[model samples]
Target chain A: MTDLTRLTIAEAREKLRAREISSSELTGAFLDAIETANPHLNAYVKVTPEKAREMAKASDERLAKGEGGELEGIPLGIKDLFATEGVHTQACSHILDRFEPRYESTVTANLWADGAVMLGKLNMDEFAMGSSNETSYYGQVVNPWKKEGSNQALVPGGSSGGSAAAVAARLCMGATATDTGGSIRQPAAFTGTVGIKPTYGRCSRWGTVAFASSLDQAGPIAHTVRDSAILLKSMASVDPKDTTSVDRPVPNYEDAIGRSVKGLKIGIPSEYRVEGMPAAIDELWQRGIEWLKDAGAEIVELSLPHTKYALPAYYIVAPAEASSNLARYDGVRYGLRESGKDIIDMYENTRAAGFGDEVKRRVLIGTYVLSAGYYDAYYLKAQKVRTLIKRDFDIAWADGVDAILTPTTPDAAFAPGEITDPVTMYLNDVFTVTVNMAGLPGISVPAGLSESGLPLGLQLIGKPFEEETLFQLGQVIEDAAGRFQPQEWWAS
Target chain B: MSVDIDTVKRVARLARIKVSDQEAERMTGELNGILQFVEQLGEVDISGVEPMTSVVEQTMKKRQDKVTDGNKAGDIVANAPVSEDNFFVVPKVVE
Candidate 1:
């Protein structure tokens, strides 16, 4: 009984199997924690306490029969972006007000097949658009970690902010999150947890709300590297429903934990040392290099020459695709609708009223880039730039680089309203976006604390479908840095 | 490369989003700021590079073109704002 909420998913699984604890007890503990913490953190948009209890009871039955799934009885948070059957699946956008899918997403279906219980839908940036969680219609998810001795609230870095903050605050053992750019990794870094954006096609995008379709991917955010590895094994699979989902068999990722990094080549790109990055981040990056080197990883100084262009080009490509993907919300089939004099007018009114400011800006930017006059200058050019960006990684991998190491974000978590400009906010993904751009796997492992006492994370970028390698390397970093947890100020 | 207010309005119309004169003006500045940021892409040399069609390297998977899923009309319109007879109701398009 030492705070059942504090047990990692791995520990809880063992305890549940041994009958030392029941899934009902574990689920109840998480529900109580969420009820206490959610008011202050705003991490959960919807809590399925009844459903969770029912699921836990079912899991207890399965466990008693010794026939439970991999994640049997383990409670987790689901980002609002994923469609949960008959549950709130808003993607934190008012556009989908009170909308619930009749069917489940393949990823969530996969988790349930492995017996994971859904605690609730976690809050996120509207349409998964912002770097900070402020863009969410439910309001920002406050970071569980605070600056040393400071009472000022900090943002849990976003789109997946609720997932990270919930895990860090022990609201849930792990949470499902999607990454388009750095949604999963950056928030995990900010909240002192482990999150991985498995390669683009690793998890089916069937039920997840579309952001930038090509860049969007689903992954897990958990308390420890091992927990993340365990969750991912159940989450990733080849699905025929999504054409982009690769046909390869999903590997047992847990086996990669504690795997030696001997003879591995860790690439440290010169370009990621961006101008105006705080000295502490650079120092942390250096420490990561030394840690990997100590673990027998050969460090190599290399260059991703087109690194500078990746973000600018991403702004164009992502928004362009987002504009197209989001065009489905025309007040016709589902969600919010604003009546107008005519069909065209209705479409206009609905979208204008439905989408948040950040979403609108991106949609407009997307429209402008794909417009007839500017298509060649913007969209096509950005695509070509994307080619070069991917080529940079392709070359590195061809040269025998096992993985690339960098800081997860330019800095640690900041106050909610500190950043207002869109372009400035987009820079938060600088170190992490290239992985999504190249369709490669990446993991962010909490590494150390910033000078301000907020948590910082080091990221590992791996070859396509090489998430096992990232897990192996991420465990090395986690082993060196140790786990970080925020002081429980909210419950009191 | 900056978008003028008129162009912003046009783009808003094209995107089927209503923006007032004031919102469009504000968006003009914001869009210009982002356009200026992305203008840096012009510096990259793309001599003979082809625009990437897909990020992953794979041939498109083909499935047998047969009737597999249907008969869930009620489920399809489960969240529709207005629906009847298993069909989504929208504002009349044809005059």
Candidate 2:
């Protein structure tokens, strides 16, 4: 039999429906793969073997009864950010040590309802704060893809690093990931996988650990474009629990996979061609435009004048919101708590010991921005620039642009500790934060190999609630570039 | 506009996260580096642009006000570090 672990969600679905493979067998294959690859990759923080078997058994019964959910019997890794009932739901932060929620996050609940089996909780940056997975308290998640012949350990871009690496290494068919300032797209770009950050509120935030409430969104990372589409259809829904979740129906995203992109106006933002962008990334971006053009997408040159200010504004607004949201972890309720002389001292000590450096830095920055004296200059000013950034895209859309295309990251994956300065790390989100700023949807499609044979991706940003368009365009790029997989370095 | 150790200390106090003199010193330089980078926002002419509180424009979603949830204090306190009578226990603040 073909390797069960190698099947895409769509391919697995067909085989299971045809009775060529049982859910138990498929789930077991993935469990075996995880047992072998997880130690080296550090992708999974907690593996739920018993829960997976139980879920797969249920799925087999459903399949036997000729009734199964869209993702019946498929195994997927859950990013530790989501609260899984009675399961580990720490956001890879010391603050959430050993915490497990009784209630399931709405996104994970939706997946389980579709009969997807839980593989494990994937690792991520503490509080989903950093660009590289190095901020994870569980230690950095190593990217499965290494540079050409060097055995140097590269970072899986984060805070969705584990999800990206797991899917890349075929430890899971697909994985749930979140994005706040490019967590999903940047990591997906780094690991040769497909990741989409649906429009804000496309999926419920009821159970996912809050990062920056306004910018945080849940989506999927998958090995194939169609797999991402399939996973997203099951993951997205309107929930009464999350008032921000839109009341629109979740469309069958798989239908968009082969949809025609002919005559589609794909805007290429001139501002994205920033100074000092790596030559290989530039060449990949040019190749992306040619691929789209060949597939009949009309590439139009455009300018987002406020693009340069996006990173600056994002740092302010995200931190401000993060400081507010993270205040709930005061050592009174769930998670870690350190002893102190009194209540005030306890709060301080608990937080000081609990949060990692990046999380602390962000929380402090958040508090600083929202402070009485600096609120107007930093927080309020950044909010105003956020408006201008969103308006830039609105203006382009008014000019009949169906979707905007750009390089996913400034460069491909970098080795751990390669970029130490926070400012340099912040630049990883330069090409992606604008999509979040505008509440638009974006997807990263692995498009080309770098000079060192590492994968690079191109992003397609779509209008609000128009993920279908991104999937269509992403498939075009995917079909053109073909799929990329790192050789079995971890397993070996 | 630069973040000095004093600024880091003050911000840490406000955020309720304790930091020592050494961490604060290191943080001062790091925070200043970020502040210097974000200060570029000053270059943009955002005159008269309304501050966007949220990208998705929506009003407060209203539903018929009634008891919709609750009655699960056990579940709520299940993950608490310390609990008593299904209530989260915290360090005593009262005299």
Best by DockQ: 1
lDDT of 1 by residue, A330-445 (tens): 88888899999999999999999999999999999999999998999999999999999999999999999999999999999999889988899999999989988899999999
Which lDDT values do the candidates have, in the order given?
0.95, 0.93
Scored against the true structure, residue A115 in model 2 reaches a CA lDDT of 90
Worst 10 residues of 1 chain A by lDDT: A1-10
Q: How closely does chain A match the true chain A in each prediction, as TM-score?
A: 0.99, 0.99
Separate DockQ for every predicted complex: 0.87, 0.85
Please write out the lDDT profile of model 2 over residues B11-84, one tens digit for every residue. Answer: 99989999999999999999999999999998998888999976887776778889988899988888788999
TM-score of 2: 0.99
> What's model 2's lDDT at A355?
94
TM-score of each: 0.99, 0.99
Cα RMSDs, all models: 0.9, 1.0
